[model samples]
Target: MQPYSHARLRHSWLPLRPCPRLLPKESSNTSDAFDTLIESFAFPEKFDFVDIDLGRIRRAARAPQARQLTLHLAIRDAPAESPAAQALSDLDAASFKLFCTPVVNLFQRDATSIQLTSTDRAYPVTPEPLETGTPLDVYSIDAVRLGDRTQSEHEKGASSSTAAPRTAVLPYRALSHGRQPDPTVAYWTAFRDPYAAAGNARAPILLSLIGLDGGSAQVRHPQIDVDVTATNGDLPSRLPIGAPDSDLVHEGAALACPIRLLTQPTLPCSHARGHGALWRVVAGLSLHPFDLTQTGLKAFKDFLRLHAPRTNIVAQRSIDAIVGLDHQPAMKWMSLDGQFPSFVRGIEIVVSLEESALRDVTLHLFARTLDRFFAPYAPTNSYVQLIIRSSQAGQELHRCPARSGTRPVI
Candidate 1:
């Protein structure tokens, strides 16, 4: 994918993000050592960054690890490609935030320096943290504009160094949601049937539930504190009891739906804005008969070891898709430059998976990070009243929990 880099920053032109990864070309000699930098930067007129006002961002660069990554996002998980172009072509500006995270062992192979080159030729650029005497370990710059290095005496300041720019950090915007539902009782209809493929072997358990006809007043966004209990027949199930990958899901199975109530904020786009961030996830596994939860997680935990990118694990095969829901909104581990515990010391979580029966599979289920980032949008409390007549194109089976204890999932 062509790297797109555009910013209204007066000092720099980089918007750090998690993706646009780079893969090195393989060579015949496996023993050969190499150091490389893969970067993508473009100044497409199609992207209007003026709304973020990144022009004032300054004075926030420190190397906690050999690898330092900074992210500037106006929107969450916006796909990058022609489709994204079409989906978001209408917007002018959008909400924005800045984050800096240090990755451990990004340069374990060899010391390498990364340089970001933006296709935007008209706008010249320069490196920040203008101090020249500091140490810059192996660095993998995410989103940045490569600026002109030309120096003029007129631009020189005290100590023959460029003046440090002021740093600006934005607070998260909170959504207004009531702690309790306006009404505890509500009806829900099938939003869509899972794709036939997911319904079979790939991942068949995904069932959607949007507000039933005229139920918007009761079912709303930021519906936090989701807890619904139900019998096996109450929830949705396309795969038979012995569904494919029985090791992961099976019969006599009781499923607990840990549904994370998500909020899709109306991102501030230019008057005629485009699509909002998309959240898609499938992460449910059946447990051993009579077990009630994802017991397979114990066996799968063998593959749960988290390590650096350029390192090796004990496994002989590459089984990375073990996580789901875009790895729960693309969750990554953080190190805080090695300050906090591993539980909280991975990558900065922009989005995260909610705690559910499937929690063991991915790191995105970190409730702490998830709440902090989306706190503003979370409802004080949330409850769903359901009456499931039938599901997965199946016959009318049962209703929501009558008394209590059965968990309901959406």
Candidate 2:
């Protein structure tokens, strides 16, 4: 007792009340009542909703060694003398099945099917001491890789130089195999921090319950309640280095910013919508670091002054022209000896609509157009943007960026 100087733990006991028995309707027969009773008894209230603790999610996002996150299945203890409690007494944890489908970026192509597992076991493990609620059943998820383990220094450098920070939503749902009804599911979204230092303190990966899908009649579709604050909370008030009005000496900005084009048009004659389709188009030129040298820079300026304006190319035509520019010997060698060849990049053209829905053929035509547009530039690592916009206010709803290497199915 003297050796154990810390305070002792205390326990309290509470009295139990009688649990109500299952009562069948007066009009029901004995067989129907028995079946109802059996169904109710078999599926007890012990298995509740599943959740991942915030701390676990934070660790998964920031920890250098964390490869996956753990999900906990809440299990409650039923009254000792109840029939439901007795039914679960000898339950085989392996019989309960749960599956997770990661719905990423609202694009079906990136979705992944992952089967959840318990601690060194499959899902739905029984907690110790069936009569009293204590430990929770655990499931591990390895959907997205985190930290330096998954990326090399060169890969990280390349990604930071060429790409923006990517974000995605991961919605989860349980699959029913006819033995039991599906359980309600929920999920959160996560994005990698592009500016964070490697293997040092950075922003914690935040995960909040963004949506929930249940079997209730009132809830027709999955309701989404995202917390956007988590992602934008720590953003600096000042603009970034290459911002439009900034005076920073960024070489990439000087080369790319001057040639940008932005236009908005309402196309009332489009086949996709009889009323009108609103479009926002933005096009720009990009030069690699090697093109920033004095001689390479001169050639770029010469091409812009002499060749670019003569082409009479708008954003749409420029995108097509850039794809076929390889065939033009004069343009391809604008830079002496082709030491620093220039190609078009950063093209964004979006067509929005306010309508019931586009016909199947209309969507098919768009897909085919994308396929043809990117075909010639496939080897050059070009990509096309396909956006789905909201009908109410012509706002962007979701964007699907299809790379030239892979064709997208509408």
Which one is best on lDDT?
Answer: 2
TM-score of each: 0.16, 0.16
Residue pairs clashing in model 2 are: none
Model 2 root mean square deviation, Cα atoms: 34.1
Give the residue spans of candidate 2 off by over 4 A.
Answer: 1-58, 61-97, 100-343, 346-381, 405-410
Across 148-259, the per-residue lDDT of candidate 2 in tens digits comes to: 2222333446757754332233433322223543343334334333354246333233222323442221112222222221111112212233335542333546474332
lDDT per residue for candidate 1 within 1-410, as digits (tens), equals: 22234544443222122222232323343211111111111111111112333223322232333243344546443335322334556644353322421111122121111222232111111122212332222122122111223222222443535633221111111121235433433322212222543332221122122222333222222111111111122112222243333313222358742322112111111111123211100011111111112343333322222111222221111223222111111122333233442322111112111222221221211121112222112122211112211112223212221111112222
Model 1 regions more than 4 Å off: 1-135, 139-143, 151-294, 299-304, 307-410
lDDT of 1 at 328: 14
Error of 1 at 142 (Å): 5.9
lDDT for position 184 in model 2: 37
lDDT of each: 0.23, 0.28
Q: Cα deviation of 385 in candidate 1 (Å)?
A: 19
